[model samples]
Target: MRRKKQIFLSLGIAIVLLAVTWWVDLWRNTEATIQVLAARCDIPAGSRIEADHLALISIPASLNRAGYLENQELAIGRWTTGFLAEGEFITTNRLHDRARGLSYPDAALGRRLITLKLEPAAANGFWLAAGNHIDLFLIPHSQDRESEMLILEQIRIMAVLDENTGHRLTDTHLATTTGRLICLDLNVEQAGLILGRLGSHDIRMAVVNENPTG
Candidate 1:
C-alpha cells in the first residue's frame, strides 16, 4: 500500500512538471502586443491632424519603441512636420504642437505670412477656406498695357478671417463667418512678388485646388 501511494505521488509530480513546461513554452512563443497610433490615411506635410486621420493599431511589443504615440488625443489638432504614409506609426518628432498659438504655422517657419483683404465680391463669394490652393491674377493697373497675368499658382490659404470681427474661421466656423480676409503662406520671393504688385494692381484669386498633397 505504501508503494502504491509513492507511485501516485510520483505521477502527480510528473503532471505538475509537464504543465509548467507547457506554460513556459506557450509564454515564450506568444508575442506580447502593444497598441500605438498610426496614420489612418496618407497625411500630407503641414496638414493638421484630425481625428479621422488617426488609427490605433496593435503591434508586437518588441517593435514598440520610444517616441511612438499611444494616445489619440496627443495627435489630434497637431500638425505633421512631414508627410506620413498610411499605417505609419506616429512619433513625437513627426508632429508640431499647435498649442503654442503662434501667429504663423510651424510648417511655414522661415516663410512669410501675407494677409490679403478682399472685397466681398473678390472673396470667391466667401467660398474659399483655409487649406485651399489658389491662383492669383493681377490686373496690371492698365498702365503697363499688359494683359492680366497669373501672378501666383497653387498658393496655400493659411487662414480665413472675418475682417469685421478679426476672428479666424475654420471648418464649421468658416460657414458662419464672413471670410473677407485671407492669409497666405508664401516664401520670401513669393511674398515680395505679391507685395510689389499689391498697390498698383487689382488682384483676384481663384481656387485651383483644395487640400493639395505636399
Candidate 2:
C-alpha cells in the first residue's frame, strides 16, 4: 500500500512541474517582441528615408499589429523588418534602409558605360573595390595639348571586372586584388570627356573618405 502511495505522489509532482514549465514558456513567448517595417510617419513609397527619418518599434505577441506598440523604442535605422517571412521574431538592428540621394542621370536611357582600366601601380595595388567612392586624377598632356592634372572627387566605382575570367570580381577579392577594370558612373558626355583625356595623361584613382558627420 505504501509503495502505491509513493508512486502516485511522484506522478503528481511530475505533472505539476510540467505545468509550471509550460506556463513559463508561454509567458516568455508572449513577452518577446515582433519587429516590422513601416513609415516613421507617413511617407510615399520609393521616397528615400534619410538616416534621421525612420525609427524602429517592437511589438509583443502579435506579428501583424497595425498600430505602433507602447514602451517600444525607436532604434534609429536599426529595425528594417520589412518583407520578412511569417512567424519570424525580429531581433537585432540591421533592418533599417540606408538613405541615398538620387542625383545620377538616366544612363540606361541612351548613355554609355565607361570602363576605366586601373594600372596596378596607380590603383592602390588594385585594393580599390567596387561601390567605393574615388577621386579621378587626370594628368593632362603638354601645354601644346591640355597638360593639367584635374581631380574629380567622389566618383563612384560601379563595377570591378577581372581580366582572367572576364567576369566581375566578387567582394572577397575586393580586399586583395592586383588589377581591376572599374566602371565609372558617368553619362556619355562626361564619359567622352574623361576617356578623351585618358591615354594623353596618367589616370589614377583616390579613395574617397566617408563624411565625418555620417
Candidate 3:
C-alpha cells in the first residue's frame, strides 16, 4: 500500500514539473522578438529595393520563418515582384536579383495591369518612378466647359517606360528622355474607366504623398 502511494506521488511530481517547464518556454517565446526588414513605404511592383525603402521591424521570434530576409543588404538592389504595402514583411518569393529587362508582373487576381503613354508634363516632368502613388484627373471635352473630375485616388505607378523606344527608363535617364509612359496597377473597374477616357478626355497625373498615413 505504501508503494502504491509513492508511485502516485512520483507521477504527480513529474507531471507538475513538465507543466512548469512548458509554461516557462511559452512565456519566453512570447517575450522574445527579433528584428526583420520591412517596407517603409508602399513599394510598387518592378521597383528596385533601396536602403531608404526598407525599415527594421521587431516581430516575435516564434513567428519567424524561413525565406524571410532579415538583412537589409540582402534586399537592396533586388526588384520587387509584387506590390508591398507599408510595414509588409519582405520575403524571397516577392523579390528577384537579376536585372534582366523589365518584365511586367502578372496582374493579381481581381486586379489589372495597364500602361499608358503620357506627355512629359503629365508624368510630372518625367520625375515620377515606380513606387510613387498618383491621383488621376480627367477634364471632359464637353462644350459646356465641364470641370475636371478626380478619376482615381492613390493609384500606384508600377513602371516608367520611354514612349519613343518602349524601354523602361531609370531615374538617372528620365531627364534625357523626351516622352514618358507609366504603367499602373489597378482594379478591373478602374482600368476600364481609364481605358474608356483615353481618347476623349484630357488625363493628368498628380503625385500624392508617399506614406499614406503620414
- lDDT computed for candidate 3: 0.81
The superposed Cα distance between candidate 1 and the true structure at residue 88, in angstroms, equals 35
Instruction: Pick the winner on lDDT between candidates 1 and 2.
Output: 1
lDDT of 2 by residue, 1-214 (tens): 9999999999999999999999999997778675554345544223433434444555664554544423234434343434333333233332445543232342345545678776676776766566778888887666654366788777777777876665777662344544567777766666777878866878887778767687
Candidate 2 residue spans exceeding 4 A from truth? 1-111, 143-146, 172-178, 211-213
Q: Over the stretch 1-214, how does candidate 3's per-residue lDDT look in tens digits?
A: 9999999999999999999999999998769788988899999788999999999988877788765678999999999887899999899888988644345554455567889887776767767788788998876776464645647988988788777787876772345547777889898889988888777788888988576577
For all the candidates, what are their Cα RMSDs to the real structure? 11.9, 11.8, 14.9
lDDT by residue for model 1 over 59-106, one digit each (tens)? 778887665898999889998888799999999998997543334543
- Residue 149 in candidate 1, Cα distance off native in Å: 2.3
lDDT of each: 0.80, 0.61, 0.81
Structure candidate 2, residue pairs in collision: 80-95, 80-96
Q: Which ranking of candidates, highest lDDT first?
A: 3, 1, 2
TM-score of each: 0.46, 0.43, 0.46
Between candidates 1 and 3, name the one with more favorable lDDT. Answer: 3
Candidate with top lDDT is 3
